[model samples]
Target: MTIHPPDRRDFARSVPVRLWDESFAADPLRHYQALRNQGPVGWGELAPGVPAYVVTDRRAALDVLHDEETFSHDPRAWEATVPDDSPVLGMMRWRPNALFADGAAHVRYRTTLIDVFDLVEPHDLRGRVHRAVRLLVGRIGPRGEADLVGDFAEPLMALVFNDLFGLPESQGDRLHSGVGKMMEGGDRATVGEAEYAQYVLDLIAAKTERRGDDLPSRLLDHPAGLTREEVTWQVFLTLGAGYGPTANLLSNTLSRILGNPLYYSTLTDGARPVMDAVVEVLHHETPLANYGIYYVRRPVAFHGVWLREAVPVVVSYGALGILAEREATERRHPNDASHLSWGAGAHACPVKQHTLLLVTEAIERLTQWLPDLDPVVPRDRLTWRPGPFHRSLTALPVRFSPRSPASEPSGVRS
Candidate 1:
């Protein structure tokens, strides 16, 4: 299992592949394969002229994820090198939150999040998700056709999250618009980042004046004694992290279920749980595909590659899924949960159970309300949003039998 470093001269000479473009968005596997061809660790550009080493091999990725000593989560060293207007900066920029910290600071911030999130019981979360799904279906059910990504997945996350964060339901659109633009990582990214910052600021300010049973208020009350500024960043990280990936996961899972007639039948007939489809998407096509970003403090040799100081070493979860599939001699069951989609080691997703509950429940509720829902276009023909960090769809249009809101079941009508 030992992987020795490749020849430094040849590795240094290899050209970095571009990841933040239409080609990568349209056919990510093709670009992943191109990176794999270079070696376990391949050079790639996250955006125009932004070069970094993208780790495509599972062993190399695991090595990077587990070895915090060699690879640091802090990107300040590299951040200073990038332009102020870099599209990727929104994602990679250092914050006081757990995602960008290392050592004791990481532990302090991470503990506060875990402690607060642990208070959310499964039943409570499921109820919130069901309520959001009901509201969404009521709006779209009467139309007979809707973009699931826009009309359902995105809004569902916003509604549930807004409720959990103690914001008015009307403010969900702000959370959705800001996070969506920022995750897309382009000219609008800066605007998205600013909008999201203001949204978090407002939430903190409101909670400061009067606390509530929401995440921000909980963080403020935690024993960590985090200052107002610290609380704001934590809320920013959690909301942005929770919303974008969960929305994408729900949309991606729906696309898989609706795209296959047999699968849809199994789901509607109760032969399979919606969770099976969700797990299948996690294994084959994860939402936050290549966002496990790490940086080295000094030039170091790792798993057959030379990692330059402060350069990003991205773990391609999408590529890792493909590689795992190819390397497997036996067929993997649909419910297998071995994928690295939630990431690994220290920075692994803290709210994975919450995320799973939200997505599965949302899907189950939607399918139950509209059993004959069908994709307007084939899944293969659908377009993806352009970005290096996320695997998100631009839209998922679908058609179903129309029903008036008044005719729907009593509790769900908007």
Candidate 2:
């Protein structure tokens, strides 16, 4: 059944709420809930003087995600309403990648990418993850103190991605650094983006001769007629999207295990499955908080809010996911995979299985290697990154008793 937009007259009565404020970045969940109380949709600035329509309503978010007809993933299709200088343009800019395409373009890009991912054997990926875990744990297990974010999760995820892409550790590190700077918009963003793009092109060029069972080779050899630029953008998107969330998942959940006594005991005692803990972390503290940007194709009203042509529509994923979690908690329900963590529709993340296996294995290995891990600082004292799109800690300093060499898990390569 087709869902038509609301009347324009209906939108005239509601006030646009501010969302790009510092308070929103610090504590988006609280602000989003307050916005929800105001109405289903509201206006906010994505960057200074750059207006966007923020959708906090669950049903409205789903509709926007699924309905690509009225909304477009391609920001270039929009009229020149947003200034070229807007910081958010860095994020919303058009790319030949699957992320910003629609219709046949989206299909072709997504098909090639998914086919490549399908080539990954789960057991092999798990082994790769374990190797990464083993390397990281071996480095820190003897120290008895570690910053989980810096010393473990980030580098471990980098190694896993390096394995997947057939890239050397040094090249992968540079790629990650460039991507991070680009995502962190400012004076450095333009240079970061250019350097990152150059790195991708160089990586793809290098991979053509050193072909193997890696993603870049698979995409390059796909039946689909993708341009070299398309292949590079797809790889960039995959690496950029995959690493941050996976690393955040590992660090955040590890923090929970170390800081929350009750939750830690439940996992260690085997009263709950480890997967259950992973699911709860996804539900309560979704790694990539706000994402899924869609521009209004034309002037339309949706869920009592007016969406003007070319205006950005931002989905509050963290807020909505936590709301779903609260509902489940109230009902005493088992963890459901329907949370908005992976997003909602055609544009949803395609590598759920890969992400899950990577995070799960990493967490399990950490817990087993350091059963007595605990936080170095109070839970409230831990710092978080000040951004609307990500929910990540600045650091996760933790301490643990050194495990004996004989106590290390079996099948973990030294």
Candidate 3:
């Protein structure tokens, strides 16, 4: 008897949340456009499941993300791809680490982070954020021009996480590398998950030895309890949560704002519109394109698609770009509609305030410092870094200068 080979139906069109694909690994927006053309929910060929619904439409994407009872964060399809000793899973299993768990668990886990997150809102950390931003811009001024990703974006973002975790400045590089690996999804190979994992292990050990009163120590000492592995996993999540996506936002927003330098004026003048612009930028580019979570509960039906119970659910952070673009076209208040970048429901990023504050602060400072910020390369000529999980720029080469070339450094006089 001859066996039939698998057909196109076997391939899942939507890629796994973090798996890097050449098509998207090279350009995130383009792939998002392609998926949008296929309609709100398309098949994810790269996904492990038999049928994966790719939600791109704004309302529909909102439906999936916000309605956890119907569309659980626990139903990500890529959990199988994660390593057996998955740091992602470690946090999910922990009590206060219940962001990955459903119902009672998610609520408990959220409480811990939400409390801290509420403290980091734009208003709450305004002084420190401005200071961090000014410090970053000042350093970039000496260089004249720099890759925002490396010099400007990374440092500014890493600063927030470091302060939040109370991790010393000395450990920045290690945490940065580990965050990169975590955001890469399946591309954990390049960063060496084992190495990153070991680093987290060491971080926990150091924190335990030092016995500090920061978030790490709190997780380690949670009354509900967590394992060393659990602390390590959350550390990875926390750092990644603060890094890649925000960096991507900086890179992408810089690209957009430089095209319109007037936003700088808006920010410097204390116009609320500037903050709205920054949030719009986050929604527009979608730094954390997708976030993968495991659904430990029952089945979920999104739209007409029926996802089986206990199925893994990967929540791509932003609505499909093309779909959002179209939705923006239809919006009465196109300026105010959030594009679902921070996600919508029970599992929406608990760190939304921290995330937005980082982006807003970075842009606000950079704009005020260098009103003449402009990309050296054209948009089409520029490239965006790719991965299923992150929509970042590999390198965002930019020139920074004063409003007047005569007043600014000769190096960045565009």
Candidate 4:
């Protein structure tokens, strides 16, 4: 595995293809297939002079993910000459959180997070999901039309996480606004970032002074003995990672459940369960499409792609899904749990099961409440959020028969 120097022309030359382009976002499967056909690895511009190497091959992506010594998650290991004001810096730049750590620090941060998350029993989380869904559905059930992503999925996730973190309604609203602005990305993103940081710190301080059964208190009491800043960042990472991605998954999965005939029939006729639909969505349209931005530790090459020290290599999970589907019919188990959507190696998402359960319970309750739900617009009319990391819809509008406020079930408090 020899790593050659980067071609000067690679940066100077006009790139006819960009993975983050609107066309790719519109029809990613076609673009991913084209990339796969082109080669095992392809270079594209994330921004001008900002080159990223995308591994479309599953085996090559696995190699990149598992090769922690050679490929690091820490941006400090990067030697690339990116400017200070690079728009993607908020995402790729190093943070003290586990998402950007490597080696001993990664282990420490990850261990503390895992311990905190383990305190949340699965059954308890499920009950929270159920209650949150029922309450959310009750609010929108009176209206015949709704945007599932905005009106349902996002709020339900926020509510569940708010309970999990023991945050008051006021703080939760601030957290939601801050996170939403940050995700939108712009000059104002810094403002949102600062606001979110302050909120997290305040919450951590409160938990330390008045320890409770919430995740923050559990994190503060963890054996890792994390610092105040560490705890704050961990809380930010946990909530940010869990809620946004889970909501996106639910939105994407719900789209399929309503749009795909096979999936719709499964729900209507009870041939395939909603969980099965979720598995299918994970395989086909993973919420986090392309991520795992690991920086090259040293000059090395794998599968004929020259990776330089400091350059970011991304795992094309969306492309991997397309590859899986291309060969799905040949697989002995079509629904095997080997997809890279949750990522791979030591950096894999720890809350995968909880996220799946959250999605399952939300979809189950939603369909039960509104079984006749249908999309307000054709699936093709829907547009996706323009970003490199996530496959999210801006909104998911749907219509169903209106329910009377009187129909609210007994003791289901909103």
Which is the better candidate, 2 or 3, if ranked by lDDT?
A: 2
Give stretches of model 3 more than 4 Å off.
Answer: 1-19, 25-30, 37-39, 45-51, 66-70, 75-96, 119-124, 186-192, 221-229, 264-273, 292-302, 306-313, 329-331, 401-414
Say which prediction, candidate 3 or candidate 4, comes out ahead on TM-score. Answer: 4
Clashes of each: 1, 0, 20, 0
Q: What are the runs in model 2 whose C-alpha is more than 4 Å off?
A: 1-22, 77-79, 82-85, 270-272, 326-334, 403-414
Worst lDDT 10-window in candidate 4: 7-16
Q: Estimate every model's Cα lDDT from 0 to 1.
A: 0.86, 0.74, 0.58, 0.76
- Give me the overall lDDT of model 4: 0.76
By lDDT, the best candidate is 1
From the highest lDDT down, the ranking of the candidates is 1, 4, 2, 3
Native-to-model Cα distance after best TM-score fit, residue 398 in candidate 2, in Å: 0.1
C-alpha RMSD between model 1 and the true structure: 2.1
Would you estimate the TM-scores of all the predictions? 0.96, 0.90, 0.77, 0.90
What does the lDDT read for residue 150 in candidate 4?
A: 88
Candidate 1 vs 2: which has more lDDT: 1
Which residue pairs collide, candidate 2? none
- Itemize residue pairs with steric clashes in candidate 1: 5-304
